[model samples]
Target: MNNSLTNRLGELAKLFFKMGVISFGGPAAHIAMMEDEVVKRRQWLTSEHFLDLIGATNLIPGPSSTEMAIHVGYIYAGWVGLIVAGASFILPAALITGGFAWVYVTYGTLPQVAPLLYGIKPAVLAVILNALWRLGKKAVKTSKLLVIALGVAALVLLLNVNEAIALLIGGLLGMFWLHFPAKRNSPEDNTNLLIAGLTTGATLKATAAVGASAATASAANVSLWQLGLFFLKIGSILFGGGYVLVAFLQGGLVEEYGWLTQQQLLDAIAIGQFTPGPVLSTATFIGYIIAGVPGAIVATVGIFLPSFFFVAALNPLVPRLRASKWTAAFLDAVNVSSVALMAVVTLQLGAATLLVAKAPYVDFVALAIALLSAVLAIRFNINAAWLVLGGALIGWLFFTLGLYPIK
Candidate 1:
C-alpha cells in the first residue's frame, strides 16, 4: 500500500522480468545475475544475505534459482512480491519451452540446438565454477568445515549417497557439534533461537518397467489430473538438481506409465537445457505429450508449485539462520555441501560439452570453445552472459564456415 513498497515491488518486477528473458546458461548463471543485480547494483541486500539465500535454497527440493526468486521477493515485499517475482521470472522460459514442445509433437524430432548448447554448456560450467570459488571463501571458514565439505563431496561422488541425505547429515552434525552458548533475551538472540530451533528441526519412489500386459495399454491413458500430480510429486521431492530429473522421467513416464518414449524424453531434456527458466519445464513438454495444451499448463504448474510454498516457509527464517550461532553453523555446513555438489555437477557438465565420446558427438571445436570460455571467464572477469553469447556466435560462425557440422 505504501508508495515506497510499491516502488520496491516495481524494482523487483523490472529486474526479474529482464532476468527471466535473459537468465540463460542455467542456475549458476541465474544466481550470478541475481547477485549482480540485487547485491551489487541495487544494494537491496548484502552479499551475506544473498549467499544465505543461495544456501537456504539448497536446503529445499525445488529449483534453487526459482526458489531464490520467491525468497528474494519475500525479502522485498512479503507474499505479494513473492508471487509476482516468481511469476515474472518463470514466464519467459515456460512460454518458450511450450512453443518448443508444440514443434516437437508436430515434428517427430526436436529442432537441433546442438550448436547453441555447444557453447552455452561450458560457459555454464565455468560460471558455476566461478560462483563456487566466490561462495567458498565465505562458506569455508574453518578447517573442520572444510573437512565437512570434502566429506560430503566424497560421499556423493564416490559412495553415491543421495544429496538430500548428505545435506541432512551435515545439518544434523552441525546442530550438535556447532552448538554454542548464548543469552536468550536479546531480540536477535531470540530470533536466532527460534530460527535455529524451528529451522534446524525441519529435517526432511521408483517406476516399474513397461510391460506387454493389459497394464501397459492402460498406463498410456493418462488424464490431465494424473499428469499434474505426476509432475507435482517430482517437483516436491526432487533433489540433486534438474539433471536428476532425467532418470526420473525416463523411469516414470517411459517405463512405468509408457506415456513417453525414451526418444521423447531425451528430446524434452534437450529442450529444457537449451531453453531458459526452470529446467523442470521438461515436465511441460512431457505433459503435452500425455494430454494437450491443458496438460502442458497443468504439468508446468505442478512441477513448479511446491517451490513457492517451500520458499515462503523457509525465507522468513533466513535472517535467523544468519544470526544464530547454531543455525549459522548448520548453514555453513550446508553451504559447503552445496559447493561440493555444484563442483561435481559442473565437472560432469564440462566433460559433456567436450563431446569426445565418438564421431558426430565428438567436436574439437566445442572443446576449444569450452577452454576458451573458461579462460575468458577466469582471467578476464568477463560477464558470463557475454561469454555465453561469444561462445554461441563462434559456434554458429564455425558451422557457417563449413568447418564443423551443426549436428
Candidate 2:
C-alpha cells in the first residue's frame, strides 16, 4: 500500500478502537458514532456513501456497524486496511467489555451498574424509535417495501419465526419482485416493482440452514473445541445485528451447553446492553463466567473471528455481490426484515421495562423528559449522547427527590 494509505489506515484503526471502547448503547448508537466519525468528522466518504454502507450491512448477516467499519477501511485503503480498521474498531470494546465481564462474573453481580442501565434502557428505547423513523423513511421507498416490512414484523412477532428466516424470505420477495415483472393483468402486478424485486432475491440460503445445524451440533457435543466452534459458527452465520446475537447466544450457551443459567445469561445481556460496544461483548462475560480469563479469550475470539473472516472473504466479491440484480433485491428485502426485527426487539424491551419486569412505575416527569428528548432527536437531529446525558440528569433528579428508589 502507499505510505499515505498506510497512514490513513492507522489513523482509522486508532479512531475506531477508541469508538469501540466508549461507543456504548447498541448498534444504532454505534452507527451514529460511525457516521459522526467517518462521514461528518473525517469526511472519508459522503453522507450518501455512508448510508449505502449502512443499507448494505443491514442486508448481510453480521453486525451492521462492524461491517460498515470494514467497508470504510476498504474504501479508504485496501484489503490490509480493512483488517486493520476492523480489528482496531473492535478491540477496544472487546478488551474493556471483557474486563467488565470478568469483574461481573467474578463478583456475582453488578448492582451499581444495574441501576445505570435501568436508566439507560428507557433511553435506548427512545433511541431505537428514532432510528426506526429515520431508517424507515429511507428504506421503505415503495408501498410494497412497507408491506414487506410490516408482514415480516408480524410474522416474527406473532409466529415466533426465526429472524434469519424472516430476513431470507423478505430478500427473496424483493429479488423476485425486482427482477421478474408480473404480467400486467396479474393481481399482484400492482405491487411496487423495486420491493417485489428485492424480496424475490432474499430467499433463505441453504447454507444458512446448514450453518445453524452445525452450530447446534457443535454445542450439543461439549468440548472446549466444540464450545469455541459453536460460537464461531454462530458469529459467522448470524446476520442482522447484536440483538440477533443475543438469541443465538442464549440458545447456544444457556440452552445448549448449560454453560450458564438463564438468569446469568440475562444478567450478561443486561450488562452488555448497558455497557459500551457491541452486544457480542456478552461473549466475554460468558467466557469469564464459564472458564475464567482463558475462556473469555476463547469466547471473545471465537465470536468475532467469524465477522473478520466473513468480511474479508466477502470483500473481494462485494462488487459482484452488489451487481446481481437478485442480490440487490434480496438486500432490499433483508433491510426491511432487519428493521422489522428491530421493532420487535424494541417492543419487547419496552414491555419488559414497563410491564413484565418489576421496575417502578414511570415517573411522569422522567417520561416527559424522555419524550422531549425523542422529539429533539426526530425534529432537531440531536445526538444520542446528549439525550442520554439528559436522561441521566432526569434519573438523578428522580433519585434526589425521592421519586424513585436508587436501586
lDDT of 2 by residue, 1-407 (tens): 67898798779878778777656567766776676567655789875455546655654456767777788888888787788888887777677767777667567666455445545556656766776666666677778888888988888889987766676677667767765644442333333334333422342352254235434332224455665776677676666556667777776677765767888888888767766777777777777777667777788788777666655655555444355555556566666666676677777766654443344554444456557767877677776666666666666667667776653
Estimate TM-scores for all models. 0.84, 0.75
Off by over 4 Å in 1: 1-3, 180-221, 354-382, 405-407
Whole-model alpha-carbon lDDT for candidate 1: 0.74
Q: For candidate 2, what is the TM-score?
A: 0.75
Residue-pair clash count for candidate 1: 0
Q: What is the C-alpha RMSD of each candidate to the true structure, in Å?
A: 4.6, 5.8
Error of 1 at 78 (Å): 2.5
